[model samples]
Target: MSDIEVIVGRIGRAHGIRGEVFVDVRTDEPGRRFAPGGTLRMGDKRRPATLASVRWNRGKLIVSFAEAPDRTAVEQLTGELLYDHVPEAELPSEKDEYFDRHLVGLVVRDHTGAERGTVSEVLHLPAQDVLQLDVDGEERLVPFVSALVPTVDVAGGFLQLADVDGLLEDVE
Candidate 1:
């Protein structure tokens, strides 16, 4: 399986007077990702960081790394992004759920088999995920939902979209 580095968290401010620091968790599976002994690459340098301890304060995730033993050391790590390398073959446990990377390169077509565009990016908004389509060099954003994106065939390398008026407006 190919490996993909995913951002799991970002180091926040130092917590209390120890090396423990608040983490702005980015992954849904924080328990598994931030579990003690789990190794996460820290920052753009990709420094190896082993989780020494993890706990929750109120609703915030507080973590300490084996490499950063004291407040001084952990403070330096503030604002650093934590990344976890995982297999690209891994799929979401639930059906129909797709990782952004999986959809990025898929061809988008209309229901009647009209070629439309290619998915270039996936934008995660508070309400829902949005697909960024590159149609004839023009960019369009489509909300990622069953109503709009009716079908997805990752293996087939394509996805079918429902023909809503104005959806493919200026294109055809």
Candidate 2:
């Protein structure tokens, strides 16, 4: 398999007997995130277990990993970051749309060709996805949209951000 970028779901805690884990999903696309018989990771450790079973109950996703043979083993993985590798073919196409993960590591720039910083992470909010930028020991949130972030050249590993008024002046 190709080395696809890891997409993180929420960290999970071991729940109940039977080696079940309660995972708080982070991705909007749960079907791909929790596809039955797929692989997932905890923290930096890549788990190569087939997903045995998964179900939603009480607003928490309960997943049974093939490697977690018993409740004791499940308890050890509590509160670990879960990562999944999703294939590009599984994603649907929308004109001019892109996955948020594709923006990571892209250099942020202003319209005047001023260098901003590299994107550290992407934050999903109710209204829009925010690009977390590490700018000189500080973090800034740039609203992910066409108006503010008008251009992105993933090939060049940089993006041109529209100068939002007061956006860079303050941190929220």
Candidate 3:
């Protein structure tokens, strides 16, 4: 239950008859996250399951765990989230790359130094990620791309957002 554990995937429906399950991956690095022998923590239960095998099916990752050996066993894992229980420090160090967990709860500010709100959530969309903020009790969706976000100072505890016209307007 540590904050350091990052969600790597969510178990979908059973893929085939041999206990293989389709995973809706959340991480950018699927090969590492879903690799054989990698251990993933299951949702709520926090049960550690080792990846016994993994295969790519039409760009989707179908995985089998040692704990789940049949379709019936994999069925129990449907809708469960898979997390990589690794410390943030152990993650790859790359410029401008950040885990969504680090951005949550950070104060979001406009380029003019005006406080917009606090980050409530981080939405990972197919095209890009978004920062969901709570401003004056209203929700705002801000694209997390460099062009709009510009800066993220986790140590400083704030996110600097570029001024995009009507970007902070109330959602209708």
Candidate 4:
């Protein structure tokens, strides 16, 4: 199996007594990632399990594992993160879109071509995606938007942000 695992979801509280659990899906392609019969690795331990069923309730994804049969079994998986081994060559098909793995570790530059920081991580939020930057040891968050982040040169290993007031500057 590939070591490149992508976080697909996190197990939430149990929904019923039949071992079904709510999942906080992290991937954009939930239908494909959380499909039935799919193999998912549970938590940091990378324990393997197969998806026995997947359904939606009130717009939330509910999933059950073939290995878990009862509420007691699924309860143990609460708060556990789910991951799928994805190939490194696989990438988003959108022209400007990028995966969190691809965005992380890239150099962050300003509009004037001045280096600002490095992308420490990508935050997937409800409203939109955010970029966490390690700026001179301090952490700063920049929304992943075309208005602010105008350029993304993945091959060049850097992304440029617009020089907006208070965007990356110190606010007094």
Best by lDDT: 4
TM agreement with the true structure for every prediction: 0.85, 0.70, 0.88, 0.92
Write one digit per residue (lDDT tens) for candidate 2, span 68-110: 8678987887777787766744443545655666678888887
Q: How many clashes in candidate 4?
A: 0
Runs in model 1 with CA error above 4 Å? 56-59, 170-172
lDDT-sorted candidate list, best first: 4, 1, 3, 2
Residue pairs in clash, model 4: none
Candidate 3 lDDT, tens digit per residue, 1-172?
3447788999999987999999999887787678899899998888998999999989989999999999999999999999886666554456778777778899989889789799999998888888899988899898888899888898899988887776777445
Candidate 4 TM-score, C-alpha based:
0.92
Tens-digit lDDT track for model 4 on 44-124?
A: 789987999999999999999999988999999999999998888777866788988889999999889999899999998
What residue runs in model 4 are displaced by over 4 Å at the alpha carbon? 1-3
Indicate whether candidate 2 or candidate 3 has the larger TM-score: 3
Tens digits of per-residue lDDT for model 1, 34-93 = 989889999889999999999998999999999999999999999999999889898777
Clashing pairs in 3: none
List residue ranges in candidate 2 displaced over 4 A: 5-7, 26-28, 43-45, 86-97, 112-114, 125-128, 135-138, 170-172
Clashes of each: 0, 0, 0, 0
Model 2 / residue 47 / CA error / Å:
3.9
